[model samples]
Target: MKKYLDIISDLGEGFGSYSIADDSSLLALVSSANIACGFHAGDPRTMASAVEKSIENNVGVGAHPGFPDLVGFGRRAMDLSSWEVTTDILYQIGALHAFVKAYGGELQHVTPHGKLGNFSVVDQRYAKAIAEGIAMFDPSLIVVTMPGELAEAAKKKGLRVAYTIFADRTYNDDGTLVARSNPHAVIRDPDTVVERVIRMVNEGKVTSITGKEIEVNGHSLLLHGDTPGSLQLAKQIKNALMSAEIEIRRLGDWIN
Candidate 1:
């Protein structure tokens, strides 16, 4: 049987006079968007604009909070206490929530960004902090995370969770993503990504870089907006899923 999946992408990842990929094109393809919350790559204006665009496109709005690393684009790890991580995530969610409310759209989810995201997956303390932070904001909101400490923390904190797997990134045998330092971390070929995503959803598994078959839960599939030709790749993946008769919708709409 064909598997249903939710499509999500990053948005609002540009500062003044600097833009990344065309977010408008991606908005047309994804059902949910994880908008950057100014710490990583977005500014206030950019966050507001992304929220507005998401509202116009009828896409689910989510907070994409990361480390306070503008220089490293939040991909570099930082030395932060669990309380600090929780507060940082809370602040970003509040910032994005204002935009979401002003645009007459409810915030649907929270997804940690970059290094913060990867860390939350491994460190139970950080994961619990993130989940606690989201619970403080809105317990009804969903947390998009991989199957690990973050997911466990979210569930234990009485927050909703939707398991997320990457469509264009390779996983490790331990179910973590391959280190970005490796040259082959991201799978850029559009056709290959589409096929891999199909397998993940339909077969409930993905092949790790070490040739291990690792099972994956697929409440949502993520595609990085900053990737080359990401817009076309997202479109093709959505089309491919549709052709396979997989129901692609927003996490908020389907998680229940």
Candidate 2:
């Protein structure tokens, strides 16, 4: 049997007059796009453009909600109540969904961005709030999650869950991503990234920062658009996966 996977990239991350990644090129390479809402790194114009392009490319559309930390790029931690988290997520998802609807495409999934995503991994309150917000919006939307509280919360809320692994980020022994504060948290080499992704998909495991091999449920592979050399890396990874005989499909199409 052939192994199947989904390739996704964080996109629509440009603010007014400043763009982050080559979304067009990346869109051609990825099967799914986690578009940024206005809160973190996008505005109405960019969001609209992203939706249009995603429709053109037949890529799955997803909302990437995050903390209202533009200066910090949603990487810095913020103090927010559970209600605030839920409402903010709902608002972002609604904003992105409107564009998706306009473009004749349905919103596919919800993947929390930056620090909010990191927080939800261990903090049940944050995870539950995220799950509740997503469930309230549309219980049918798939929630892309790591091995963490968010996965459990999504399950409890009767939402579909798709497990994901980061292609450019390192993991901990417990299966959580290594914090960005750590210098070695990100894997920069394209070859290394490709090797790890192949292993994760084929063997269902990842080697942690501490040299511990940990199990991973690899449904989707996340490639950060903002990473340096990401376009080249995405191409390499895609070609490598194809060469390895793995089928790449959009999560919304096949993930149950």
Candidate 3:
């Protein structure tokens, strides 16, 4: 049987005077949060406030590092060297870790944000660079994402690894996420996404965009915070899981 999951979402995505979602409200729903670390979508004040909110709600805080693409919101991939990727990861982790420590909370994990995240899944060099940075921090730090070369790289470095399944994104026949550029890539239908989430938790599988069953279960489920009615969707998923006798817990609690 599939184990219970850790439902997590992105926090600290807003910067300056702009806000994407009500993170304070999101904290009350998710068990963990991937707070943006200024590269992709957060500023210093935003990160600090996010840390405080997570601490208040007892939600696990993690570093959400991206490709330093503030213009594209980290969704655009950048051509970077292995060294650049390694240092970027370390820099972002350290920046978030400082706030987490100041607020008397632990940095639960490191989840690469946006295209940097997707690249690590298929690119061995990117995976290794990210892994090397995590190992430098503390070889046992938890790394959360999909099961791929990233997880493998972390395991080889004595780091804890946990996979993530997107609650709204569709997978491919090869088990990778369907490129977001495609119109059908994101399942905006709340009912459909909710049902797929339950199936993944209970059956350990996700139907690809091409209509194939893929082994895509994970310890964590990634929910987008910026989407409209996101909190309502989160509530639905949480309620459904609870009704089905599944415990919604922090990803760090069950990371391997």
TM-score of each candidate?
Answer: 0.97, 0.98, 0.97
Better of 2 and 3 by TM-score: 2
lDDT of each: 0.91, 0.93, 0.90
Compose the digit string of candidate 2's lDDT tens values, residues 62-168.
99999999999999999899999999999999999999999899999999999999898889999999999999999999999787899999999999999888898
Give the TM-score comparing model 1 with the true structure, all chains together: 0.97
Clashing pairs in 1: none
Off by over 4 Å in 3: none
Say which prediction, candidate 1 or candidate 2, comes out ahead on TM-score: 2
What are the candidates' C-alpha RMSDs?
1.1, 0.9, 1.2
Sorted by lDDT (best first), the order is 2, 1, 3
Across 1-256, the per-residue lDDT of candidate 1 in tens digits comes to: 5466889999999998798979898899989999999999999899989999999999999999999999999999898998999899989999999999899999999999999999899998889899989998889999999888999999998888898899999999988999999988999788889999999988889999989999998788998888878888888889888988999888887686
Global CA lDDT of candidate 3, please? 0.90
User: Going through the candidates in order, what is the number of backbone clashes in each?
Assistant: 0, 0, 0
lDDT of 2 at 249: 98
**Could you give candidate 3's per-residue lDDT for residues 1-256 as a string of tens digits?**
5467888999999999999998988888899999999998999999999999999899988999999999999999799999999999999999999999999999889989899999999999999999999889867578998989999999898888888988999889998998978999888888999999999988888889888888876888888878888889989988888988888889777665
The stretch of ten residues in a row with the least summed lDDT in candidate 2 is 224-233
